[model samples]
Target: MERKTLITSTRNLAQLFATLEVKEASPQYSLDLAWPNSHNISVSIKRDDLLHPIISGNKWRKLKYSLAQILGSRTLHIVSFGGGFSNHLHALGFCCHRLNIRFTAIVRGDYSANPSPMLHDLQMWQTDIQYVNKITYQQRESPAYLTLLHQQYPNALIIPEGGSNKLALQGVAEIISELDQHYDYIIAPVASGGTLAGLIKATAHSATHILGIAALKGQGYLEEHVQALLPQTYQHWGICHDYHFGGYAKRSNELVDFCNDFYHQTRIEIEPIYSGKLMYAVKDLINRNYFNKGSRLLILHTGGLQGSRAIGQRASIL
Candidate 1:
């Protein structure tokens, strides 16, 4: 059950306004939103015309700045990992076609005959989908796990899951270039920590505080994940290990009910994986008076809404 944000105000001062005009490299789309009081958080859906295109919002933001680094050959077989029905996979497939590049998506689960709508889109994008067992999928970042993939596909440009790596951080960090210094807080859900890490690192030593709502369960290891980009220096900022509904892709009835209540109140949909937990955490923090009332908090609505299908099946999709 997803509801969009109500754009009630005359104008929002906090949202990072995007170029809605489609261009040569990418097209533009906006997040249907209910503008927040502090600052409206939004992302542009860059509609790329080819395979491996970033169908997900900010997928373009995460990829735009890294194309040069990734441009080695005219035809490159790109590899990335995600669940059986990953938006990342779908986007990567479409994007690859656009660039005329060969693409491979190392998925976490067995190929489902009847996959989620998003996964079907990946197939439509002609993603060469490979399956890994659940246990092995859990260890994707481990050296041995990478070794296995490398042994099989040695030359593939394997992007880390959630696109959370140093290169990805470079892409995400470029977001602040268009922003002003008025925002007091920044909020985004922590997945593999690439986006969160980018935001925090970009704002390091600045007055603006960054908060990440964990969208996976038992993210105690996420600190190690984010810091993997930087070594041991800024460990304190990667402080979200809870609030992930349950691990990476699990949710409960309570969270579903919460999403419904949230929709009723705000008229905005919060996917079970990400924005749902973020809203839950942010509301709690607000009730506790976590920040100054007048200070602006920019909640980045990173679009992973594709995952909503599976959760919706469980929640009885509306």
Candidate 2:
């Protein structure tokens, strides 16, 4: 799609708002699995993965309020940061295209010579892509770099990397209201910590235990980041750093095999980067008898099926 083909009328913005307003909450399904222990434990999954084809799961949740702010403003462009296979940029590009706003991505590292599947999708959406070295990318959070970006795109709304902001947290917190019943445990995959932070804030007064399965290595820093996002200190949540398998975007044969077996049993496709690690941790914890009898677990499938293509290619080569 080209910029010329984008519809930039207020009518279109109104229609888009209406489209988002009427979207039904994603469904949650109970899973029937035989546990080794004799405890009466129930497991369920929230199908945020089926929320949308391109802009699915927490990606949509994180972007919903930001997109609304952009639509309400006079800014004609959107700017953000991401890596080669960032689902954040992928979803942002498509959202900008649909909203008739210009989109630019400050991509980490140089991937123009060999674009990943996500980069290809961004280009298809006509997102202006800019490459920056790792050293410069690290300066993304600095005021100097942010000022420079604002100078480049004068009337642009700049979103932080991973779309983790107050507005994004508000969007993720809505997941709490969509639940039909209370769960003893709420589990989700954690990368940049936005989703987990939202869950912690939402369940602050409840007895529910929020669990974050880290998807990257060296996740000790995630606690600080998540704490910085919240209004107050919360003690009802914990993060598991053991399920990453290797690191961000890194997969092992065990994770791949587990994903295949999970798909065969549940009929729900999961990629290794996010949902696979979450499901793996759930099963592992269950076998270890981490939960008591009659405990209910709710797993959030935060969607990243787009990354599965890369996993499939890697598996074939191995």
Best by lDDT: 2
**Cα-based lDDT for every prediction:** 0.62, 0.85
Best by TM-score: 2
Candidate 2 per-residue C-alpha lDDT over 128-225 given as tens digits, one digit per residue, 9 for 90 to 100: 99999999999988999999999989989999999998888988998999999999999999988899999999999999999999999856798888
Candidate 1 global lDDT? 0.62
Residue-by-residue lDDT tens digits, candidate 1, 122-217: 777777877778887788878997888788776777777766667677656755654644467677777777887787778776777777888776
Q: Which ranges of candidate 1 are over 4 A from the true structure?
A: 1-54, 72-75, 235-238, 261-267, 313-318
Per-residue lDDT, model 1, residue 298, is 65
User: TM-score, each model?
Assistant: 0.76, 0.91
